[model samples]
Target: MAETRVGGARIRYDDVGQGGPTLLFIPGWCTSRAVFRKLAPWCSTLHRTLVVDLPGHGESSLPGMDFENATVVDILRSVIDASGARQVVPVALSHGGWWALELRRQLGSRIPALVLLDWLVLEPPPAFLQAVRALQTPQWRQAREGLFSLWLQGVSSPDVIRFVQEDMGSFGEDMWKRAGREVSRAYAQYGSPLRALSALSSPVPTLHLYAQPEDSAWLDAQRSFASSHPWYQVQKLPARSHFPLLELPEEMAARIGRFIDARVDVGNPLDRLAPSPS
Candidate 1:
């Protein structure tokens, strides 16, 4: 892991492999770059893979940075600029997707492609959001201390469960609060994922991988957004949880590879492989 100072944070990132069209991997909340350990190697074979531990997660340091959405976007941009990669295809997971969207917004044509893994793009029901916010009180945070381990285990693989347990255990309550606050603040400031999608003017090809137990509203929102922006496409993964990357890393990586290949290849690989539209 290499270190670079981006704002108040000392960002830690992995820049490995050699190729054009760099692939920037961003893990979800509370997850370190370790989540992409298996996936990175495969991707590195084809493109330079840059994986970063977002501020306050993994080996990264957050001197005094706050977890606002805009702040995160700025930090991410700084990291990419510092990396010296001119063009990149951002592959982000969960909360990291927000930063990816913002990157496309700010950088526009500089980003060749965008990939999202089970990202939470839709605003939950108003009732659900209200209930969730109510649970964020310090009292509730203290009460729900070990509950995440149990809930996570039910949805994720053993490896993912272990990672979450160890990560949450290391920083305890403070880290937990920071992660939650970041997501809540992002939602509050930016509105829904639909709003973010609507604001984008770039036609950069986007691939959204959504996991199972799909929310209807989320599907509808993506559909509507794609209607206006045809380059944005969504695919449902077979996994049953939000952490599909942890549940099926190899499969997910392969899917991402195919997507990137199809978009970036000089001539369409699918066109050569598929029968002539008959």
Candidate 2:
């Protein structure tokens, strides 16, 4: 494992395998880079793969203004710089999609490729967000345990459950509760990459992957995001849930392995997302 000190925050990251065409993975909210435990092994066998924990999420401790000012853009900058790869591909999922979008916005042409595993691309609109805020009002907060409760319900991954249990169980429920609440506050205020996505904002070659057993609503949102890109590839994993990289490791690896082997716009449909920069 390698660590990088950036913006006074220590980000824990690791590099796997050796060679050109590196893959950098960014996990979803409340999850660790360990989420890629399966995918990393497969991808590393064929290409250099880097898996990193975002600040406050996993191995890294939270900076003072962690979510207050920490944007995925800056995070990726640190990761990319540390990798020493002029062109690196980002493999993002869920909230990780926001990070990937920011990457393309600032380094569109520079990114060799992008792979989004069920990334968030479309928001429910201002009205919906406002409604959510209403739902979070004091009256509702008491009635409902919290947004974190709903979010946990949304994620149906045994692997995630086990990881959080073994890794964070000692912290007690209060610590986890506070962490989840604070993260929810940040999410409510700073989530906009979905609506911010546009061809002008992102012209990088990209891959969008979704699992069939996952939420169709989310899957539709993912497809909409890929379609909006004007140039991107979309793949639907069969018989898998939200966390196929962990749940269906072998199949997930086979899919990603095929994608990596094909290279940019050659002999691979997953190459559809990112066409060679014209």
Candidate 3:
């Protein structure tokens, strides 16, 4: 376990293995590095891997700070710098994709590739929007519980269920409220993950792996986006849970390995020194 201080917050992470173009795993909102326990260790065998417990989540402490995007990115930046990684591939899950995209936007060529796990990258549906709104009200706990029920619709594994319940249930009211507001703010700012990636000045090779969408239209939208953007690729895995990384870490790791092997040239020196966005 290694630690980096951003502002007064102590961001904790697990840094394992040794190599260039490290894989940095970022968990979803309200979750921690434990979410990537199975996945990150597997990837670490092939390349350097850093699994972070974002401030206010997992083992990290978020003293006197809100769980906003800029602060999270700053902490992530500190982790990368402290670990001395010249090139990186951010494997972000769910809402974590927001910070990963922002990091790529800030760091540019230093991030050669990106992998998103089961994120709602297109325009959120009315139901999702309503849910986010509900999360801001006094009944936020109920709203969050409802969202959890929805996410676990078809999940049956005891391990996965316990993980989701415990981790997602661990946050306090302030953190949960901040999570809701931040998500709403991210959608307001970037519209969607697709739009966020599109706004980038330089293309970063990206692979989005999803389990299932709320509807066929969502899947089609991602397919359409990938078809138009050469830098983006989308794949649907045989998964039914929202937390696919927890449910299918081995499979997820294998798919990510193949994507990196095929898309990113880890040996290319120029990719490591790619200039920051102007």
Candidate 4:
């Protein structure tokens, strides 16, 4: 466990392994680095890995800072610099994908690749949007619990279930309220994860790993995007949970390892794969 101060807030992270092009793991909203406990250590064997607990989550302290995009990116940049990593591959989970994209936008070539886990990369449906909006109202707790139920539809793993229940349960009302607004703000800014990826100034070798087959439409959208964009790819994992990291960490690590070896270990691989836009 290591710590760095960003904007007077203490950010905590785990720095492990040793090599260039470090794997930086960013957990989703209201979740801690513990979400990456198994994944990060496994990746560390292949390359240096840094798993962070964003301010106000896990062991980190927020003090007076707001948990917005810029603040999160600043903390991430500080972590990368403190670890002396010249290059990074952000393995972001859920909403953390937003921050990962922003970090890449800020750092450019320093970000070699991106891996998104179980994020809604397409435009959300009206019901989904409505559910998120409800999180800002007085009934936020009920709304959050309902969303959690939906996300855990097919999850049967005891560990995964307990983690989600406990982690989400641990947040206070203020944090939940803030998370609701931040999520809505992120969508407003980038439209969707697909739009954000497309808007990148440079094509980044990216992968979206998901486990929800119930939403066939969302899965199909991801496949469609990946089919057209050589720099992007999507894979649906067999895990029956939204939190595949907790359910199938070894498999996730193996998949990520293969991606790094094939697309990122080489020099400018996306250049050879991604055609120049006319």
Candidate 5:
């Protein structure tokens, strides 16, 4: 475990093993780098792994600012810069994939490839954006505990359920409110990650591993995007839960390992970099 001071926030991460192209892991909302604890070792054999805890979640500190989408990108960039990694393969889960994509959008070719694990991507309609904002407010937070836990029970394993419950009990109020507020702000401001990625002129080589029984909207979006851009590919994991990484770590790691091996081994090394804007 290590901490880096990125501006006012203290970003915490676990740097396991060493080598290249560096594999950076960004966990989803609510959970921290701890979520990747079981998965990192399998990947470390081939690539250096950095499992990070974004601000306001896990062991990192957010200081005075809110954790919006842009801020999330900034934190990831800071971590990459601090590590002196010239080229990277970002492996992200859930909402973390949005931040990873945003970073790739900004840095361009510095990013080599992306592994999206059951990530949610949608431009979100106007009504949905409004609804998201509404859910972010204090009123929703006041009424969310039971409903949220129940929702967790339906989608996650007993371990994940326990983790969520414990996380909520320990860092529930601030983390939950801040995450919801920031994600809503991101959708309202920058639109959905799917929209942003779809708009890219050159597609980043992406491998999306989604859990079975996925969100239809996400499936539709990724399918549409991949159909047009051959560089993108999507596969469904055998598992049905939201946190498949936790439920099936070995299978998840094997799938990720295959993607990393296949995608990174393409002929021209330069092809891995993002193309310059036209």
Candidate 6:
């Protein structure tokens, strides 16, 4: 676990392996780099892999930095510039995917390649965000509080769950209570960075791993965006509820390995080996 001070936040990251085509792994919000423990090693066989913990999550610190200006994109660009890696691929899940698009918008043709998962957009319009903001009912609170379980089911290693229960118990009420506020702030107040997703004009090798039928909206939207842009590949994990990385880290890592390897053409060891998604 290496920690660096990036723009007033103590960003924690895990860097492993040694090879060309460095990979930056970004997990979903509130989750730690530990989620990629299994996947990083697989990527290491062919590429230098680094998984980072976003601020306010994992071992990273939360700063009062403007969330809109110093967004996930800023943090990632800073990491790339600071890492001294000439070019790197971004493999992001959930919120990480949203930020990756922003990076594409910021970096233009420099991005090595992109791999996005399930929920990657700036979701919820102003009115919808406002509506969720007004949900103070016990039922809504309970549902929000339980979002962790639903999310974790995708990537819950035994150790990962233990770590959350022991170290992040305080996050339960605290996180759910503020989820709506943060969403609204990022969506409405932040000026909607999601438009950047459909606006990416780069020709980088891109792949989207979607949990089929679950996030059909996001899947369809990104696919549509990709269709009109550079060549992109889409892998549908049928019936998979969001969180392919957590729900099946081995499969996720293997697939990512194959994708990166296929892009680089060195014959990725994980290629054609992943059990076909059900």
Candidate 3's residue-wise lDDT over 1-278, tens digit each?
88888888888888887555789999878888888888887787677788999888888998564557788888899999887788889999899999899888899888889999889898888899889888888999999999989878888977678887988888868888888899999999889889889989988899998887657777888889888898999888777787777778888889898888888887766433433222
Q: Which candidate number would show the highest TM-score if scored against the true structure? A: 3
Candidate 2 per-residue lDDT, tens place, 192-265, comes to 44444443443566666766435577666666766766556667776334566777767766776666556443
- Each candidate's clash count: 0, 5, 0, 0, 1, 4
Instruction: Name the regions of candidate 2 deviating beyond 4 angstroms.
Output: 125-157, 164-195, 212-230, 260-278
Q: How do the residues 1-278 of candidate 1 rate in per-residue lDDT, one tens digit apiece?
A: 56678665789888887565778898876678887887788777767778998778788887573555676677778777776666778899777888888888888766878898776677755753543454466754543454453346446367666666675446545555566676677788778765676667756788988775455766777888788878778877777566677677778778888887787642323322222111
lDDT of each: 0.71, 0.61, 0.84, 0.83, 0.71, 0.61
Pairwise TM-score winner, candidates 3 and 5: 3
Q: How good is model 5 by TM-score?
A: 0.83
lDDT of 1 at 149: 39
lDDT score of residue 37 within candidate 6:
69
Task: Please report how far candidate 3 places residue 140 from its true position, in Å.
Answer: 0.3
Candidate 6: lDDT of 1?
55
Q: How does candidate 1 score on lDDT?
A: 0.71
For model 5, the superposed segments whose C-alpha errors exceed 4 Å read 65-67, 123-131, 142-156, 212-221, 265-278
Off by over 4 Å in 1: 65-67, 131-136, 140-153, 214-228, 264-278
Pitting candidate 3 against candidate 5, the one with the higher lDDT is: 3
What is the Cα-based lDDT of residue 181 in candidate 6? Answer: 46
Residue clash pairs of candidate 6: 154-246, 154-247, 155-246, 155-247
Model 6, residue 269: distance off in Å is 20
Candidate 6 C-alpha RMSD relative to the actual structure = 7.1
Ranking by TM-score: 3, 4, 5, 1, 2, 6
